[model samples]
Target: MSEASLLKTQVVTLRVPNELKSRLEQQAKSQGVSLNNLANYLLTTQLSQLETLSGIEQRLRGRNLNDLKQKIAFLLNKVPHNPDLPEWDRL
Candidate 1:
């Protein structure tokens, strides 16, 4: 990533329900962190979790495909080479 692509601090206005805003402020105060910092921390944590989950999903998909192939090969090996019944059409 380039510095130019990085996000620099920018101010934006947001309107939240009064109760929610108060709750956030209270939580921030209790945690001894500014509301902005707390929000940023939460977002960063969630983003990291999402990245981790994505990697896990990719691994699971690869495993599933491999298992399917193995099952198909096993079934093919079990198929009967010769039928026990005589051919009715030839009679």
Candidate 2:
């Protein structure tokens, strides 16, 4: 199946205050586009930014897990209950 076909579309009903609605319509008209197209364009831009941020977060999370694993391994390999002799720090 095509990528577009795999994605489903849904309609959303939003209630905007009159002033904001008027501004959006005015902005759309000034840009020579339909109100729906303008809204969709704005949403697409914002969603793209969020998607990029999410990908970055996923990458960082993977690195954090690896770091935690390394720390755990280091701790596990330490000597068991070794005495902290005063001379060790007497330099």
Top-lDDT structure, candidate number: 2
Native-to-model Cα distance after best TM-score fit, residue 17 in candidate 2, in Å: 2.0
Quick one: RMSD of model 2? 14.2
| lDDT (10s digit) by residue, model 2, range 1-91 | 8999857678898899999989999999999999988999989999999999999888777477878789988987784654675766432
lDDT of each: 0.84, 0.86
List the RMSD of every prediction in angstroms.
16.4, 14.2
Query: Model 2 residue 36 lDDT?
Result: 89
Give the winner by TM-score: 2
Candidate 1 structure, TM-score to reference: 0.53
lDDT of 1 at 65: 81
Clashing pairs in 1: none
lDDT of 2 at 18: 97
Quote model 2's TM-score.
0.55
lDDT of 1 by residue, 43-70 (tens): 7999999999999897777477878789
